[model samples]
Target chain A: MSQPDPLADFFAADAAPAVDRGFRMAVMEQVARRRLRVELALRSLATLLLFVGVALISPVLQRFAQLLGQDLSQVLLVMLAAGLVAYLGHFWLTRKPVLRLPHLRFF
Target chain B: MSTPPTDAALVAAARSGSDAAFARIVDRYQGPIRTFLRRLGPYTSDADDLAQETFLTGWTELRGLREPARLKSWLFSIAWRKAKGEARTMARNRQRDHDWQEIRPDCETPETERAIALHQALAQLPPDQRAAVSLCLGDGWTHADAAGVLDMPLGTVKSHVLRGRTRLVEILGVDS
Candidate 1:
């Protein structure tokens, strides 16, 4: 027969919390969130690098545009305006009122 | 009955980005890890948080674990480090006092008194000694296993366990 161990008995009284479904879900949720963050960060980095590369080559592109009798600056301005309009259109369609202009606020 | 997947298999799947496999690992070890943290002095209150952080660290660094067979001890080591780091900055003494007050009742039972005294005596021990006692005595871990998790020498772990057990018995006035 084994003798009663007081120390072990004391520890036994302080029972461990039951392993529940919630803990595993919580941990997996964290892992998913981490994965999402990493993906977002990488995408953002790629976008930034693309933008920097375009900016760096703008001078050479501008010279080529002049030889072709086209204004690169105007083309770039039109693209930027299109991008802004698309962004605002998205916000408006999504019902994000904060970005709506005064006349567009009602919609 | 079908046997559950082995640690190595689960670890390999988890490293391959399978959430289900990692969740299995979490389910398998959370109880032991939390209990171990609770035994480590003054960490009972935040053992859940420590356990969660340990899992999160394990998830992010899964690929770096050289030996998947050592996953259990690796997780415990991570948990031990998290508790130790938190213990240094948190006002744990105040929290321990508050816990005592919170558990106080109009009628004090012998079990309650013993529980309170046991935690108090545990709090009084040095952190390393307390960790040794908690892992080896409270959790029934082998001395070598405790030593690995604690990053302590085998001799040091044995010594800490012996001295820590002696101190606990002396303080609680209980027979070892």
Candidate 2:
């Protein structure tokens, strides 16, 4: 076997920087705290958007149903049920666990 | 002596809102993550940025990790994704100059010649084979560890290492 090249070893060793233990710990603590804040902020923004969207669309939907000689309350109920079903479907699709398929053998 | 707390314990604590525990996890794995990024061809500055992004993403998604004991591999997986993402972004932005210059940094005469030769040899190999050699030999990761970190099949990892080593020996004119 040939000897290991010193140049290769040197390049590998010098390629990465020296990490400061204390600074890294501090940065991690900062990131952890920031993550919690970001999560909470996203949740709040999503809730706000949901409320605003419903508020802005409810009256418009009701007026359109009434103009078409349809019962506004019944139309609203159907629409609400459809929206719930769609939302549930989307949630199920997104949150579903990744399933590993069975191995296939070919002779 | 009290046994040191395991990675799972530290990860669990972080999930439950312990900043110090999360910091410990970062301290434990940052070196390996940085080395991995460097091997992927990022210079020090970009490598540091990507490393920081990896940890940030890891911390945000830590709660969703099913197996806390596999934290090291999990962290490496995130780093790999981040590095690839950055590479794509750089390419899209027409920032090839920055990347190429970073990877092929200037060195003194003999060192520069060797570095260029090694870089050329590595570039000729397939990306997976290059990663296998850089991570396993350059970064000092075990074959099994590199396999787990790279999310490759163990057998595939072994083949990549063997093929890559043989190619490097031939390219560098190393005697058998």
Candidate 3:
């Protein structure tokens, strides 16, 4: 008896109609847009956190100045700016070389 | 000299907020993703929905991937899970029907008919066995690759293929 070619038959039977490239492009575009929105949202949240942190701390420093009798606001502003610079430096360092990683060899 | 970026390159770019890089990933894997979904028994309409969800989940979770070279397997693993979940939901909704007509195609050449029969025989096997056979025969995945994709032990995957192939040969009335 002949050995039937199951794999050949399977491929022939499963050959679907060609997909519309335009439809595929549209789907990719939708995904891209969604990713963009997510990144934007993350950046916006980071900015908001930075602003809120500074805003809340500024008033506290001003109140402390009344008790200490020193120009604590100027000192606080410089410290805040310096801290922001350090944070930016850390972000830059972490963001560098964001692409290279070891490939998984699962074969 | 900077070499042209590969798919992994594009994926990294996407992870770091590059829209174009993300689009590249979507473009590259869409066909394979769609084919995988189709084989999992989803109708074309529902296949599209599941495909979208698969890519979306992959995009959101790409950062967790330790090895970018295994991207195809990773994507397939996600697609497999999504398809299985959908199948379970579908089975619950249509519990009364023993025979699922979705397994048959409208147009059938003699070759196509035999292929459908083979698929039907395959569907009768357990999910892991069916998956091992499909990945090996349909997707051209090696036994080890199929094992990784299915999260099964290599020996388990080999057994599934051996048993699944034996059953397929029997149902197709082919001599080994």
> Which candidate achieves the best TM-score against the true structure?
1
Error of 3 at B111 (Å): 6.7
What lDDT is reached at residue A27 by model 2? Answer: 69
The digit string of per-residue lDDT tens for model 2 on B1-176 reads: 99878999998888777878877888788877776666565345677778888988888789788999999889988987787677666456446534564464445666555655566566557667877787776767788988987789999999998898788878877663
For model 3, the stretches where C-alpha displacement exceeds 4 angstroms are: A1-4, A15-23, A36-51, A54-107, B1-5, B93-119, B174-176
**In terms of DockQ, which candidate is stronger, 2 or 3?**
3
Per-prediction TM-score, please?
A: 0.75, 0.61, 0.66
Global lDDT for candidate 1? 0.80
True lDDT of residue A27, candidate 1: 81
Better of 1 and 2 by DockQ: 1
**Residue B130 lDDT, candidate 1, scale 0-100:** 84
Give every collision pair in model 3.
Answer: none
DockQ of all candidate complexes = 0.23, 0.11, 0.16
Q: Which residue window of length 10 is worst by lDDT in model 2 chain B?
A: B90-99
Best by DockQ: 1
lDDT of 3 at A63: 81
